[model samples]
Target: MKTFLEVKQLNKTFQPDKEVEVTALRNINIAVKQGDFAVLSGPSGSGKTTLLNIIGGLDEATGGEVLLSGQVLTGLSEKELSIIRRDQIGFVFQAYNLIPVLTAKENIEYVMRLQGRNQEECDTRVMEVARKLEIETLLNKLPSQLSGGQQQRVAVARAVAATPKPHSC
Candidate 1:
């Protein structure tokens, strides 16, 4: 299998003041291959979230590099990063972040829309994933109307609906 995502010597530090610095990640390195189910499990404040952010391009690293699909992530502009995030990566936050205005189906379709997928393609893919996860009934319900597990399933479905891209959280 090919490498889907790779991080090398990744580091991140937070500076509240010139004299005070908090290291969020230290010399972290990891890779996920195509079709691989990767898990970043750790206790709270254990850098799992920090590492996820770097992999998803949601946060910057203080040192080292991230490569997704052979493109170096460092020095990319915000727009470029956004394009990469939309085109190549899909993220599901632990928080179950869903749009307040969009229905469950709409939420699933949003990612396809961002990737410039046609309406028919988006609809078919959303339905496919929804059925695979057995969330077809909840597709019309709002996030608030669903249980925690249901919401998490929807998030996963939305992330994986676009098969052309690698999805991460």
Candidate 2:
């Protein structure tokens, strides 16, 4: 079996100036096989988000490599990274970053639309995930109209609707 995600000697550093430097991550290593479940748990300020951002292509690592299903993500151009992110990774952000104007259903359908899926397919997948997540009744509601848990559920539904795509931290 091949690794779905791999990180090796991952290092991240922040240098604001000659006198100021902070190391967020150093020599981090991780591997996850396809269909496996893994978790990253730590207290605040533990570089968890920094590591995640680098893995998701939302941030650059100062050193090391990230491989997603065997594709090296470190040196890819922004557009290339964007394509990988769109087609290969689904992110459920901590803040539940739903578009304020779009209803739950629309928010859930957004990624599918970006993937160039037809309306019928997007709608079917959205409904399927909504049902699975028990958020079908909240589809018409705006993000502000739902509770935190509901918003999180919708976010999860949106992430899951983009099925067969690997999810990032």
lDDT of each: 0.85, 0.91
| Tens-place lDDT digits, model 2, residues 128-161 | 8898899999999999999999999989888778
What TM-score do all the candidates reach, one by one?
Answer: 0.90, 0.93
Per-residue lDDT of model 1, residues 1-169, tens digit only: 7887889999999997889999999998888887788777989999988888887889999999999878899778899999888877778887978886788898888878978889999988999899999999989998888888988888888888854743564
**Residue ranges of candidate 1 with Cα displaced over 4 Å:** 163-169
Q: After superposition, how far is residue 30 of candidate 2 from its true place, in Å?
A: 0.3
Candidate 1, overall lDDT?
A: 0.85
> Which candidate number has the best TM-score?
2
